[model samples]
Target: MPIVYRLRQGKKMATNDRVWCICVADYKLFAFFTDCGLMWLDTKHNIWRVVSGDMPRKLYGGAMVEYYGKLAVFWRERISNQKQEKIRCAVIALARVGEEEVRGTIEWSGVVATIPYVCGFLHCLVASD
Candidate 1:
């Protein structure tokens, strides 16, 4: 039988929203991506928090990987001005967080690269220690 994991939602989720990827930094501490944005889940307490305030653009699809103690997200960022979405990479590190919700203190975040003409859905990213 397959195992099902139900999470408490912080807000309403769209019908098309789905979890793109999940990275577990520690026990019960997981960060995941949805069509809306990046979100945090505390399995211990069964509560969810929105970590990503405003993503520059919609992430069509992608994956999240933990590398060198940092969270890296590789996805296609939709560009309204461009015909095709660009492949971008980002590094996320937690700066400040509360027990219930994620606060505004993000240690650092930035776009590492933007590969032209590359479809993010056509590839996958892997990380190793």
Candidate 2:
């Protein structure tokens, strides 16, 4: 389910950031990747945390999905000064969260499979056996 709340003034996550993707990881928590970095809302405590773990700057937009108790954030980045770019995916484990937690940590991150050309608006789905 989706939970909605109002933003208070002078808080950390109240910046003018453009949201790229949002994923709800159960009932009480939801996370989104934005221009300012990764942020999550703790509905029970009414708190927000900026959890962009080791993510390089300048990722304008991306996609996120919940899979096997983890969040996979897929985005594209400029790989070279010649304008070469490629899609990347970051796997984040959202366990052990608390009201005072600043941000979630990225357990593992890496690039996606080789693509011949540029692309945007990434999406992910989960499967089970």
Candidate 3:
């Protein structure tokens, strides 16, 4: 049988809320994004936890990827300019502290691109040789 893990949601999840993105990093940590913001499953403690520092304030349909040694989060939002969608990316550097805690520091974040149409990131991938 497969082991089932339950991630704790800090806030009351509404009926329409959905998981936007999930990614794994070093130290056997699994991170996910939702209306609850970015949270990770700490395998050692068998519990879910949130990142320490700055995180995405307005998280909606988004995607996350493991890039190099950091995590890159991508999401979209409607801007004031002719109702265009603003696609943004945030690079977060992770570090483990106090045995079972993982802290995230945003290395950099900005708008990577924009599209005239309204859409969110359905998926994200990073490949290197």
Candidate 4:
């Protein structure tokens, strides 16, 4: 089920940014890929929470989605070779740690694919057979 919460700020949510992707997952957690990193909307508390603040690099041009009730992040990392880079996917299990805090734990992370070009962009898509 999808959950919806009212923004107490009484402002418009439709704004332009470098957000690569934004989607809501199970438990009604909405997320956005922004300059402050991946953050999720806490419906219970009506606040925005960071998914991972200690990520290795400054995130840019990536995708975030929900998979099997967990949050999945598609990020790119550069390798030693200039022509090829790695695209990694991380599965994070988000849980309510405290009354005002939600924690995201990486259950699995792996290289989803390797592109033949540097700084490539990938769009988020969902499909099933």
Best by lDDT: 3
Best by TM-score: 3
Q: Which stretches of candidate 3 lie over 4 Å from their true place?
A: 1-17, 33-35, 120-125
Tens digits of per-residue lDDT for model 4, 1-105 = 222333877555554334556778866655554455667676666677676534423445567777888877787777784777788887778776666666677
Q: Scored by CA lDDT, what does every candidate get?
A: 0.56, 0.62, 0.71, 0.66
Q: What is the TM-score (0 to 1) of candidate 4? A: 0.68
Backbone clashes under 3 angstroms, per model: 0, 1, 0, 0
Off by over 4 Å in 4: 1-6, 12-18, 32-34, 52-57, 118-129
The model with the greater TM-score, 1 or 4, is 4
lDDT of 1 by residue, 1-129 (tens): 222345565445445456667676433354454544776765667866677444423455677666555566676666677656566666666544556655323345555546554544443455556
Q: For each candidate, C-alpha RMSD in Å? A: 5.6, 5.5, 5.3, 5.8
What digit string (tens of lDDT, one per residue) describes model 3 on residues 27-46?
45545544457777866566
TM-scores for candidates 1 onward, in order: 0.58, 0.66, 0.76, 0.68
Query: In model 2, where do residues sit more than 4 Å from their true spots?
Result: 1-15, 26-28, 33-35, 52-58, 81-84, 116-118
- Candidate 2 accuracy as lDDT: 0.62
Model 2, 1-129: lDDT tens digits are 233335554234344556667777633355554445667775556656666456544456567888777777777667665455677887777655455554456788888754544555644765879
Q: What count of clashes does model 1 give?
A: 0
